[model samples]
Target: MEGTSFLKEPVGGKSVVGKIVDNITNAIINGELKPGDKIPTEGELSEAMGVGRNSVREAIKILEAYGVVHIKRAEGTFVSQEYDSKMLYPILYGIILQKDSTNQIVDLRKVIDVGILHLAVAKLAAQEMPAHRLSRIEEALERLKVEILSPEPQVKNVHDADVAFHMAIVDLTGNTMLQGICNYVDKITRRSRMMAMDQIISEGAVEKFLEMHQKLADLLKTCDSSQISQIVEEHYQYWANVKE
Candidate 1:
């Protein structure tokens, strides 16, 4: 209301709180509001948008809960300045609630993973990966290999190892936003991923499963992204099959 006019009157058809959330979100996205910028106080927003202070309060609470904004006791509410993994919870839970989201989750994971790999490759080209970092990834991979190849593997152990192995690769990329996205997508697809790994081992395809993990590890070492698509696709085959 003072100088920033992005907060306008809420239109009809949606809940007042929802519209307020939308207006504020759009403002942040369009650069009318920026990170660390304090949004208008509740009284100002209420007066400017012709909405009740209660509605503005509710909307701000929701946004804060989602990590879209942070409130300081005396300072006022400001756009979050850094990546918050909580921002992804809505998407994660939305996918979880969908009737048939396994395919979508699998595809999402593949795309994120492939992108992460490419980022890792580019990082590798620019600077030598720390020996300790590569060792940690290989350690996770080794754990997966051992768990999957055991005479009688525990599903939980294998699943945890599988997740750790891939997450290690994601962490290697050193991008917080990608890490947050990958972490949530992993959560959304957890059940299906575990089931897929279980079936792969049961069907004597453990070798292929292990090989895919090996190839993923090798890709970081080679700094080659040409085959990333194929490798990631193959990595998700079991999960895709289970979802089908």
Candidate 2:
């Protein structure tokens, strides 16, 4: 594939406007451009794209209208949430912007994730998922338990474990949209999480967080989607308590 930031053309029919919109959008969609990362200044993008600053500005305006980015007064520009299929754009914007805690996000995650996993499970067979998935989920859960219990947990591990847990679910769903949204949220909010959580991870707390993981595995093992939602919510509530 072409670099994530570059658009693919039919080898000869590429247009300049098409390429600029295509490349910038590709960068954002492919994680080359990220949520908190500022877009290149108008002057910079003009130079880089070999287009006039007016063209760059127009493209940015179009992207803003698409709900793909937001421009702050002095903080420059940032990416928005990956487009949502379930929630309206305004609602998703509120949830992302007004959230004061990763715990709050965890709360939203639990509620929204419940619906997603329900749809995902519908895509799978009743017999069971695969053994590899059970192992991946369990391993991801184990890593999370370690992060929660370790006296001096690194933030990187927690981020990886967290991503692993959710990505594992994306795997279960086998849906690109599910994975895309997960990646989208991760990109958009990851910086705030990194900053806010740096001091909180090792703030002297320990507990059996893995029980929920065990419960989820149990539900999956028996092909029971009924309890999976509760298990997911129960697991995330621990993090939600960080604000309490």
Candidate 3:
């Protein structure tokens, strides 16, 4: 565990893995290593951080589990920007072990969602959805259907599709800043939802959420702002029930 600390100042008996995880997480969050950027190699990281290669490897393993970085054989490791939102495995476990609840994340989502919903509805276009954009929604909806129908749904993938569905909605606005903000929230919200729903929530919970996302996608395709508002209102009622 030599030099395994965040600052390499020789910390206490806490898990070296945890410290390394924090350091790498901070790097990504602070934009020191932006998405699509390549991170230093395992050997380089070990030397730079003054930690053992094993310790650096273990840290990267934790990050890899969170979808924070992608490892390529013979190529190298690259930062994954679309992580957790794209996949939630070890992250789901880590959050759950902390005794956090999905409802809490849902609450946060409610705040961000309300604003996004309003903007999306107001920006709907009758025929302006580019093929690529429409394709995103369609794929997301298709994935949603599969999740809802499958008894043992792949919740993470379904959730990914859910984000994709909403991303298409925000993309409709053609606002780069708005889209980026929406994506940031999506990443943040996902960590919580996967922890709560995928790990600690009900068995068929994903199916229900998949159903909700499907309905939203269907409404989005209609390209009607008024309908979007109505659809979201009805959809939110389910969220209310979920709490009780």
Number of the predicted model whose TM-score against the real structure is largest: 1
lDDT of 2 by residue, 1-244 (tens): 2243343322124755556666777787678878666676777676655677776677777677766777998777677766534324444566677747455666666776787667656655553555466577777778888885677677777776767777787778666666766665666567655543454454543343455556765665565687866677666554555532
What is the C-alpha lDDT profile of model 3 across 1-244, one tens digit per residue?
3332334434236776677677776767776768987777778776766678888898788778667888989888888856354244453345434544445445445655666655555555543445456667777677667754566666586567667767876776676656655676566556544444454225555555556666676655665445554555555554334432
Consecutive 10-residue window with the lowest summed lDDT within model 1: 3-12
The residue ranges of model 1 lying beyond 4 angstroms of the native Cα positions read none
Give candidate 2's error at residue 101 in angstroms.
7.8
What does candidate 1 score in Cα RMSD to the true structure?
1.7
The predicted structure with the larger lDDT, 1 or 2, is 1
Arrange candidates, best lDDT first: 1, 2, 3
Each model's lDDT comes to 0.86, 0.64, 0.62
Better of 1 and 3 by lDDT: 1
User: TM-scores, in order shown?
Assistant: 0.93, 0.52, 0.48
Taking all chains together, the TM-score of candidate 2 against the true structure is: 0.52
Alpha carbon deviation, residue 126, candidate 3 (Å): 9.3
